[model samples]
Target: MRTMSITNARALIIMPAWNEEIAVPDTIREVMKYAPDCDLLVVDDGSTDSTRAVAMQAGARVLSLPFNLGVGGAMRAGFRYADRLGYRAAIQVDSDGQHDPRDIAKVLDGLDAADICIGARFAERGSYKVTGPRKWAMQFLAFVISRLAKVRLTDVTSGFRAANQRAIRQYLDHYPAEYLGDTVDSLVVAIRSGCRVTQVPVEMRVRQGGVPSNNPFKSGIYLARSGLALLLALTRKRSVLTKLEG
Candidate 1:
């Protein structure tokens, strides 16, 4: 489906790319076609490859970080940029091409009713398939985040999401800074800060290229890190940060 027409969307698409030279260009082109109304910004997270050049050639405004900041750091930079640019809204799309541009419209729709809109891959009635220990961890995390959110969340880890002006302002001031911090942690931050968050069912395709940083060993570490993060989120004092009233 064509991206929702925002005639005056003033939207920015933040794509964090790191050594994704193989897929970044293609991803940018597709986003350009699907969401032409939105400005595309590719945050090159210090890729050693040609990600910056290729993304620029594909017509995306490129932000080349001096060093690899991981996806979460890169995302923070992108949001800060958006905040300065006076964008009305912004969405995060990975450069690996796993996200379907067609689903962007659906997620953007939630901005009408909520401060943050997530593209949920396993929401009720979603057709995407998730398997293995990864599935178990996600389901457990989803349950934990759902409880904190006071609403059911089927895909708490989804990176594909949109934030309205209110949420974007908060993001500019503060966002969790940690490996894998942007997903569930960001949701907790958003909710605790009083922002209303909602999800839209959106199926994700297999990643276009590049390998995940997960292995058996790393998987165990990830579980520990994420579990610790959630625990901290639970006990920490809720921020006095004002939630956006969109």
Candidate 2:
């Protein structure tokens, strides 16, 4: 396994929260306990709740968006922040508390030689309950993404991921805007850019509160849109010439 150089200790953890006031503090606190050396940033995506205040109280730098941007927009904003601050690496953790902050070290370890490291929940056996349709949809999407990007990823939509400076800069430059389609856009971008991407086993939990934003119907639509987008992205010949050109 490739290990991160000691000099690259300046890592930042960014959590994009949307009305997750009740859970943000605990997530931040857990993350701090797990990765104290890493800085934390909470991107409040136009949350009307006390997300910002709670994040601040947890000692995290908070960035409030004037309007509600979906997950992709919020993540794009966080990437920009990481780039601007010159952080060596940035790890994205969801604020819903489904993603365990304790597995952050696993992500960090995977990033030693990779430009991007994604937490693959499928690699481990877990008790986390997922809706039947959603689970099937995710599996299908992962298969499609793997074929298009030519990378065998176990979990394509997993939000828990770590990226290096190069990955952050690339996302800031070419992140997709419309129908972000979960995190497929970011994963495809990283793959096409030839960024070294790795996946490690990580345990995930079911959300503690709040309804899942993506219902079965919404998930179907998202899958269709994402498939179209991926086809277009793969066929279009831009700067990313090969799967690992960079």
Q: Cα RMSD to native, each candidate? A: 2.3, 3.6
List pairs with backbone clashes in candidate 1. none
Model 1 lDDT on a 0 to 1 scale = 0.82
User: CA lDDT of 77 in candidate 2?
Assistant: 92
lDDT for each of the candidates?
0.82, 0.78
1-246 per-residue lDDT for model 2 (tens digits)? 233456347888889999998888888888888777788999999999899998899888999999888888888898898888888888889998888877887787777877888898887656554565667667777887777556678887788899887777778766665565337766776677677777888889877667867677876676677667666656533335223222
lDDT per residue, candidate 1, 1-246, as tens digits? 454645226888999999999999889989988887789999999999999999998899999999998888899999999988888889999899989987777788788878899999987645676565567678889998888778788888899999988888777665666755788777787788788888998878778888866667666776777787777666545555554343
Give me the runs in candidate 1 sitting further than 4 Å from their true place. Answer: 1-8, 124-127, 214-216, 235-238, 241-246
